[model samples]
Target: MNKTVNQKAWFLVLPVLLLVAFSAVIPLMTVVNYSVQDTFGNNQFFWAGLEWFEEMLNDDRMWGALGRQLMFSGIILLIQVPLGVFVALNMPKKGFWASFCLVFMSLPLLIPWNVVGTIWQVFGRVDIGLLGHTLAALGIEYNYTSDPFAAWVTIIVMDVWHWTSLVALLAYAGLQSIPDAYYQAAKIDQASRWKVFRFIELPKMMGVLMIAILLRFMDSFMIYTEPFVVTGGGPGSTTTLLSIDLVKMALGQFDLGPAAAFSLMYFLVILLISWVFYTVMINLDKREG
Candidate 1:
């Protein structure tokens, strides 16, 4: 049977395709162009083929920033995933309380990124901020502006507070999708709580958990605004992640070629890591299935 295929859907999608090309593709092409070429005054450009990439690869500053970025992302994942799942497990399963909890959990995610940073920046002031004042009263030597450890702790805690709810909500949705029959079967089999979670709920939530992990990984890796506002990559660049370093190179120093190269490499690293994560998770899912 030869039936004519409907081609009308292409028309509807054309705008989005054009928009992506204009927004993402064009800018990427510009970056690539800038990466291999050097510019002087009056918009003059000359080929420097691979020089910038080589320099960036050998730069200690870039490596340090990358290490910090990786560490931050790793810490966020380690803390948020388990914490989010635990919160999800404890949340009300139904009724008005469930609705209320969902709304409350969503509140942190609603604030804009820069605004969240600003809120934390003010909230951590030693003289006036509630957190700082309370800590001071307790004889705690907490000062994010001067102490690297304190700065790191503040950013990590802020991130966990802001994003854990996202993981919880995703896990909750996965939980909601599970049929009651599974629980009934587990109950009939006299499965313990741990057994039920291990043999059923955890498996069911794996798909959403993978999603949560990837989303959190990418966001944390590229994180800029919040930490920048709060710490300004300060305490002697102890918190200077890749994005902040790149911005400093590009705009702060006007090193366009190196910055462009740095950005492209940054993009590639994220893409490569994300691919690995996706591949591993998909394989794990298949093995479990």
Candidate 2:
């Protein structure tokens, strides 16, 4: 019953493993090293142990940024998931229009993150931007640079515009995978639209929906470039999420030790929350299954 294993497959993957080590592992190790030690210039470093971690933990600014980060991520999920699913439900399931719709839906996701930010930054300017000028013409006091609420709304809208298409596309794929027989059966059973969705489509889409939720959650939680470019964490740090704050600490103030420590904590927070989301969704899927 003993057959020789194909150990040679490892050779094919070795390059990828090496690439990952060089690209991700090495940089991670450097961050870890920086996090635990303090430097006083002249290429000198001294052990700081967990002092930076403690300081970061106690810092109110970090806490505020974390709160805003969590709030932003939560809002993104709440809005994007439902909207995406609804869009998927309404999208043409087949034919040329379906192909066109797919291409159109993909347009936003195709743009680079920084480019999306820049586009929004210009688009939201009150003096010249179409949206801003129209709002101004209507006497709407919309100023993202000066008003915290407006800044939050603009970023949220921007994110929704940018990422909801991803969720819709995923959901659409899930819908496509469902057997047409199920719809036929539902029709024969005199099932209502809501009933068919609840009893058939929704359950079938659950796996992909979970994926969409997790992806959106992680992306939103770690969001940086777009909001940073659009709002620059302005209106008195009202929109200063964790990533922006981390960059400021690391580069703006050159607090390397603390910044490194903060980054590690940030990584941990993302990892932990992602794990929780994955676990909960898996359990829910299992229960439904």
- Give TM per candidate: 0.94, 0.93
Clashes of 2: 0
Error of 1 at 12 (Å): 6.0
Model 2, 1-289: lDDT tens digits are: 9998898888999999999999998998999999989986676889999999999999998899999999999999999999999999999999999999999999999999999999999899998888888899999999999999999999999999999999999999999999989999999999999999998999899989999999999999989999999999999999999999999999898888999999999999988988988998889788878
**Model 1: runs farther than 4 Å from truth?**
1-13, 281-289
Give the lDDT of residue 163 in candidate 2: 98
For candidate 1, lDDT tens digit of each residue in 1-289?
A: 9999999978999899999999999999999999999987467889999999999999999999999999999999999999999999999999999999999999999999999999999899899898988999999999999999999999999999899999999999999999999999999999999999999999999989999999999999999999999999999999999999999999998889999999999999999999998998899789878
Model 2 residue pairs with clashes: none
The Cα RMSD in angstroms, rounded to one decimal, for candidate 1 relative to the true structure is: 2.4
**What TM-score does structure 2 among the candidates reach?**
0.93
lDDT of 1: 0.96
Among these predicted structures, which one has the highest TM-score?
1
Pull out the clashing pairs in model 1. Answer: none
Error of 1 at 152 (Å): 0.3
